[model samples]
Target: MATLEDDEADIDPVKMILLDEEGEEKKLTTLDNGAAKPQMQKHYIRSIESTVAIRQLPSEGLSFQLWPAATTLVTLLDGYLSHLSESPLATTLTALSNGGDNGRKLKILELGSGTGLVGIAAAVTLGANVTVTDMPHVIPNLKFNVEANADVVARRGGTVDVAPLRWGEDDDMEVIGREFDLVLASDVVYHDHLYEPLIQTLRFLLNAGARGGEKKVFIMAHLRRWKKDSAFFKKARKLFDVEILHTDPPKEGSRIGVVVYAFVGKN
Candidate 1:
């Protein structure tokens, strides 16, 4: 099987137009050659008054870079932590917080944790124990971001653990376990070939038994790029109840923005 980097190398340079903090459209190009340099992007968690730094290696592959949807999810998490009742995640997070955990810190698992932005932000914002997982090759970068923000996470009484989790791998899933209160991901639904494996992994996490018999929730932030993306959701709905949690307004020259969805095991 071709590695993620190998697959990335086969594609032509991907041009992505993303919305900046000011909602301005910015163009970014991903090249196959090792021409892009590593850079650190800082995200401020207003709720904690601190910043989480992420390292991006664009030349490595998508797994080593930040995506626009990841930013949207992180922003929502920050707002949710700020006690903003109007936040898109307010209702869902509120229920998870009060769901008989007995005041214990929430345990979260993030899949396809590219750059670890969403997972790291969740750890800092929710004061939860978050495990960020991806392919083995991506663990190093994921750990770097986690360590870069360790102090901030510690200050919030949260912790982050990095692990390798290939979608559809039972052994990987077994090693990670299913004791988490929630699952998270962003920009993980792009590749058409990965759809089945991704959905299989979701089945293992959400449909399988969860801690305390509580149905686990999977929250994913995605930016639709192709019409075929609908197939993944169709397969997912067969095993889980899927709902749209939030939708970001489109940036200039775009028709759709990031959309956050929630998935849970069907009753």
Candidate 2:
């Protein structure tokens, strides 16, 4: 895992180019962590659809810092998933919202859950059983943040768990047995070196649906930082059916662009 410094403004990303089948070339956008302070700090995220306040403890490593892609996903979940609207994700949301007394909770696994913002929002607002995972070094603060909001999540009939997952490790994969309806990741493609391991993890989780299990869906919210970042998407398109659900410019006039994608097994 790479460590990011307190200030990333001067860190120019590795330049790369991407071309489509038609030979059309497009510039890749640079990623910005966005106002992330590398210090022990607490953050408050308010739900747009409800009065739930998600508490976050961002401490220690770069993985603990809050990122904009997490915020975008949280906002999307808070604003859109709250209602029982007619969308591709509606069935999953319905299962989550109705899980409490029905004894059938919609299980969710969040990979690279920095600060656990999006997962916490899902637990507290949607009452889904969410397992938030990240690197081992970042698990302490991640667990602390989860415990700090345990009561809020429990009160809403949801539960939060934390695990240490280092992408392509066999032990980590053994620990994270495949049994989730939805898999989530936000802004995890910043480092080009991690593309293979990250995609491997996704493949493992997505393949859990084989063997007569329920269909699984993967949703990722990404902030494109450079043209090379598209490499991950290109690699992923070969493994799963990918769809762009939403797109928006980075907040506060950042040069990067944000897009949310939903993926399902091709079979």
Candidate 3:
């Protein structure tokens, strides 16, 4: 088992390039409409063993900001790609399912994609086609980040698509119906109200794979915030075979521990 230290990465420091100066005229222009100025934060993701450069922002809401779990998952995924054939689950997650030799690309779907780091990592590192989704308000930022790294992903023989998906919505589920070989999520199970809805979404995605006779997998990295929020994991266990792939407290930043889990439908 590889420790988090083995896969640790960093976020680069923000540059001092300024877009505009804050002056009395700027304040007056904004105060005329009584609307608050937009605040956008820039971020750079630094990987230990990957060449991809990822930048993201909080375009709409708290849901659109980059989270620590995203960095952890991408680092872990980058590490896992080095030893793919060692684990059956990893092989299934990344291998081609055309009934021939393995070591081919995969189709991935990322739930609650937020700033699109993990999805981009899947595309750039694993050479997988990834669809990154989130709520409608967050789609703009998600698309921005995905497009920001378009060349890097393409250079690695992968592609990225951004979409809006609200969990437990039939229409949203239809937009992503049965198409992905793997599903990825990070830091999504925080709210207790989302427990059943998240489970329903997972069930829908896993059953899609079953209908196609392909063994699909859902991989998630969650940093537990409250004991009661474990309901999502508890609910997931009833529908899928849930296995913890990795667990480690954040080596830097806040002390939230990330636990990666692989889930497959029950037989």
Top-TM-score structure, candidate number: 1
Task: Give lDDT per model, in order.
Answer: 0.82, 0.69, 0.68
TM-score attained by model 2: 0.75
Candidate 2 stretches greater than 4 Å from native: 1-59, 84-92, 95-102, 210-212, 250-252
RMSD of 2: 9.9
Per-residue alpha-carbon lDDT of candidate 2 for residues 1-267, written as tens digits (9 for 90 to 100): 421221234323543222222323333333275433333333333443233333333324447656656766766676545463444445545643454345667678999997787888877766789999998878877887888777778887889999989998888998998987788888888888999999888888888773246557788887666557667777988998987777766443355456778887777
> Residue-wise lDDT of candidate 3 within 1-267, one digit each (tens)?
943323334222221111112211112123345543444433232432445444333234447556667767776666666663344445555454453236556778999987787898888777778999988988877777777778788888999998888899999898788777788999797667888888889889988653248667888887665556555666777889988777765544434466778898987
**TM-score for each model:** 0.89, 0.75, 0.74
Question: Between which residue pairs do clashes occur in model 2?
Answer: 28-227, 29-225, 29-226, 30-225, 31-225
Cα lDDT for residue 183, model 2?
A: 88
RMSD for each of the candidates: 6.1, 9.9, 8.6
- How many clashes (backbone atoms < 3 Å, residues ≥3 apart in a chain or on different chains) does model 1 have? 0
Error of 2 at 260 (Å): 0.6
Error of 3 at 144 (Å): 0.9
- Rank order (by TM-score, best first): 1, 2, 3
Lowest lDDT 10-residue stretch of candidate 1: 3-12
Better of 1 and 3 by TM-score: 1
Q: Which structure is stronger by TM-score: 1 or 2?
A: 1
